[model samples]
Target: MYDYAVIGGGIVGLAAAIAVGKRYPTARIVVLEKEQTWASHQTGNNSGVIHSGIYYKPGSYKAQFCREGNRSMVEFCQQHNIAHEVCGKVIVATEQHELPILENLYQRGLANGLKVNQLSAQQVKEIEPHVQCLAGLRVPSTGIVDYKQVCQKYVEIFQAQAGELRLNTQVQKITSRSDYTVLETNNGTFETRFVINCAGLHSDRIARLTKANPEAKIVPFRGEYYELKPEKRYLVNSLIYPVPNPAFPFLGVHFTRMIDGTVHAGPNAVLSFKREGYHKTDFNLRDLTEVMTYSGFWKLAAKHASEGLQEMVRSYSKTAFVRSLQRLIPEVTEADVIPTHAGVRAQALRPDGQLVDDFLLVSSQNALHVCNAPSPAATSSLEIGKAIASKIPEQSLLASSDCCLVTTNS
Candidate 1:
């Protein structure tokens, strides 16, 4: 029997396990992953950008965790001798009409407590010679690092502390008793005093299995990308982002220079027919049926139909995607980029059609579920884990409710 069992070996789960071990040094802990390796899904398939918390709302969980996580992540990397660079990013407005939007984003960055440098046309040109912009905001804390490496480092630390890891073990069901919880997995059965569900793609389903009333349902949005040709990579020096459309959940297409020195563009967001689908044709009837039947899905679709259509168009037409990129870098052409790997985002949507923008954590007496951990999650994984571990009542001497009451009074 283990004191704690964390589901999912992704960055979030590994971070959670690490935190538990640190907080309770002698506690027996196990991390369960259904895949053969850690970060086999979302964590492995991402444009590795260490976000600076410039885009999140001020005082929100996202802003708090990301800002702190940026610091902690860099420190961890430095301590581990990981290769990373604090190469700043720029959000540019290429057209005259986009200038005000760029200014607004600068204000938001300031509100989020980020160091924002508003740049003129000449300053933007100096940073990225090939790019054209009416205005821009320089976010110096943004950088890039391989998240897969970070996850591996977590595993090494966890194992060094004698924590256990179980891979290729799909969790089938979870049954809770008054004293402990029995988790049924394809590999075997395990009983633990506490369970933390960090299953990224299947988090909602796992919560439902444990009888937690999660506020939103996970809807997979596939972000498709293209890699710039080797010689044509000069379009971006670091990361060039677009002024986000407030109505849409996704940040528009832009340029990102990966840690490997290759540049990638696009990532048009479309309704993925299947949860794990990487291609436009890949579909699963079961997944499709679930999403189609859910009332919240329809509400979400109806609310963003126009933007969804445009995303679909860009997904199919390389030229259309190039046009979106051309807004930032005028020289990019369809031939400059080639199709690349795609990752599905596990977006949580409320019944009222509002996208859950921040981290969503649901807790019960015996279990804690992370239902929504979107962008910047990788950057904030360590901090997020520490935060979650702090919430585990058994680790604290004072009663959970009493502590909360005191917190409120204080």
Candidate 2:
């Protein structure tokens, strides 16, 4: 018997378990990971950019968590001796027609309380010499860090508080009793008073298992990237993003300088057939069938058919991907880049063709489910965990009472 059982060993799940353990020191806690290692999904495969809350809407969860997360992440790294860099990023507009949109982005960044400055073409050149832009927004707070390392650190800290980790445990069913819940897993069954469903890819499915009606459905979008050759790494100083297409769910292809001192280019978003699929042909028929059958999926596809088609074209044609990148830096060529790793984003879409923008949480009598956690989630994991820990019913008890008084099987 455990006080809490956390499903999924992604950064968010691990962070949640860590937060819970701190608040409830004597409470038994366990984390279930379907994979052999943690951060094997979104957290491990992301672009590794510590977002500065520039692109998110002001007063929204994304904006709040990102800004707060940026500060906290820097502090956490310093305290734990983690390797990270506060390399700033630039969002540029190459064509004159994009100037107004660029200005709007700058204003939005200002509203979001980010350290943003509008840059002239010459100023942009001063920062990123090889880049071309009509105008741009410089976000100085953006940075990079290996999220996999961050996840590892959390695992260490969580274990210090006596938290247990069970890997390669695939959950099959969940049943809630009057007091506790029973989790049937591939490894063995576990009983716990409370559960946190931080299962990244299969979050919605987990919620349905607990009889909760999650309004949004998970739609996987694969982001394919290319790394710049060693000689051309200077093309980007830090990060170079395009003026996002507001109509689409993804931030358009961008260049990022990773913490490992390598610059990567072009993460073109396309519909992924497999949830964990990194390759172009890594498809799961069941996943594809579920997405194809969802009315919301078709609605979203029809709404952004042009952007969707362009993404597919870029995925198949390297020249097209380079063309998109050339919009920011005219010097980039197909020969200057090579295929890098890819990541699949789990975006939640509604039947009305709306993309769920914020960090969405849905809960039931015995379980709390994180339905949508996208970019900046890795950066915001610690703070997000603290927030989620506060919401659980056991939180108040843990903060004030002794675990010896609460009977697990009562």
Candidate 3:
């Protein structure tokens, strides 16, 4: 029997295991991943942007963790000799109506204690020659990195500390007993004193298996992207984002110059028929029926029907997607970009039809469930892991006091 059994081998799960091993050296920890490889889902298919704490509400978990996580992530990258860039990004206002929203963002950034500066159209041009904007907020702390590589390093350090990893291991059911939690998986049965559920896409399902009621349901929204043609990459200097529409949960289509020197644009959010569906044609009947019958999904759909329709249009029409991109960079055309891989976001929605905008953690007798961790999660993995580790019950730690103590160098 192990002391702790972590579900999912994504970045968050790996980070949690690493943090647990650090805090309790004697505890036996194991991470179970359904996929044969780590980060094969959200962690691997992300835009790989290291977000600054500018967009989140001040004093919120997103803001605090993002602020601290940015520092820790950069430090961790440097310590491991990983390739990363602290290149800044710009949130621009191309239309007159967007100016006020841009100003509000600047004020929010300031309130969050970031070194943000506003730039005029000419100043914006100076930074991004091909971009046209009436005003912009330059966020110097925003950066980019290969999160997959980072997750790999996390696994390496975690395994070096004696943490066991079981890939291609799907948890079929979970039962909590008086003393321990029993997990029945496709591979076999395992017993552990405690369980941490970080099973991103199917987190709610996992929680239900443990006999806990997750207040929110997981709704999968696919974000499709496009990469600029090699010769057209010069049109984007770094990252260029539009003034976010408050009515929408998405950040809208943006241009990002990746660490590999390729420029990626888009990520228009559309409802996915399958939880793991990466292509438009991919569909799952069970996943479809769940969302169709959910009251929260219908309520949310009714509220944002127009925006949702527009997203669907963009998903099918390259011209419409290019037009959206033209708002930030006027020179981008449909011919200049090619469709790339899409990522599915496991967004948590409440019964009242509201999206869970913050980091959500639900705890039971001897288990904790991370029901919602979207967007900046990849950037906030380390701090989120530390936070989850700190919440593990004291009794669990005391129970493993007699095991062999082995502190990790990481």
Candidate 4:
């Protein structure tokens, strides 16, 4: 029997396992991943930007974790000889009405203790020659890296510390007993003294399997993207973002230069029919029924019906998507970009229709559930893992009487 069993082999789960192994060197730990490979979901399909904690509310968990995670992530990458860039990004205001919102963002960045400065239109042009903005906030700490590579390094170090990993092991049920928690999976049954649920897309489902009500439902929203043609990549310098609408959770369409020197733009958000749907044609009946019937989903839809319709339009029409991108860089045309892979965000929505804006963790006697983690999660994986590990009771690791049955694979 293992001392700790972490569900999900994504970056967060791997980081948590590493933290637990460090804290309790002698404890037996195992990471369970349903997929055949690690980080095949959200962790692998992100924009790969190392967030600078400029957008999160001050003194919030996201702000604190992201700020620290940025430093630690860079350190970890350097220590492991990983390829990463500490390039900065700009949040621009092209329209007159967006100027105030840009100033508000600058103030928020200052309150969060970020190294941010407001730039004039000429200064913005100096940084990004092809970009046009009335005003901009330059965040010097924002960077980019390949998170999948980082997750791989986390797994390497975790296994080197004697932690176990079981891929393609889908947990069918979770039963909490007096002394241990038993997990029935497709591969076999396993028992552990403690369980940490870091399942990203199906986090709510996993929580329910453990007999806990997370009080929020996972609503999958797909973000579609387009890559600039090789010759047109020069239009974007590093990263250029719009003044995000405070009322919305998404950071509208933005341009980002990847580590591989490719420029990606236009990720318009739309309601995804499948939890892991990467294409517009992909659909899951069960996933569709769950969201369509949920009262919270309807409430959220009614509130942002206009914005949602616009996102849908951008999703189907390349011309509309290009028009949205033209707000920051007026030179981008529909033919200059090509459709790329899309990513589905597992957003947690409350019964009252409020999105869980901060990191949400729910705990019981012997288990911890990561209910909502998205966006900067890839950037804040290590800090988030440390936070989750700190919450696990110390007594659970050293208790001898808690030993339970272990099922060996045949």
lDDT, residue 39, candidate 4: 94
Candidate 1: segments with Cα more than 4 A from true spot: 395-410
* lDDT of residue 298 for candidate 2: 91
RMSD of 2: 4.6
Separate clash counts for every candidate: 0, 0, 0, 0
Q: Please list the C-alpha lDDT of all candidates, in the order they appear.
A: 0.87, 0.87, 0.90, 0.89
Summarize candidate 4's per-residue lDDT along 1-410 as a digit string, tens digits.
88899999998989999998888889999999999999998888889999999989898788989999999999999999988999999999988999889989999999999999889999999999988889898999999999999999999999899999999999999988877999999999999999888999999898888777788899999999999999999898899999998777899999999888998996889999999999999899999999999999999999988899999999999999999999999989988999998888889999988988887786654777788888899889999888777767666532211111111111
- lDDT, candidate 4, residue 397? 35
Once fitted onto the true fold, the runs of candidate 4 whose alpha carbons sit more than 4 angstroms away are 397-410
Estimate the TM-score for candidate 2.
Answer: 0.95
lDDT of 2 by residue, 181-251 (tens): 89999999999998888999899888888777677889899999999999888778898898888778788
- List runs of model 2 lying over 4 Å from the truth: 395-410
Candidate number achieving the greatest lDDT relative to the actual structure? 3
Residue 317 error, candidate 4, Å? 0.5
Candidate 3's residue-wise lDDT over 372-401, tens digit each? Answer: 888899999999999888878546432222
**How many clashes would you count in candidate 4?**
0
Provide the TM-score for each candidate, comma-separated: 0.96, 0.95, 0.96, 0.96
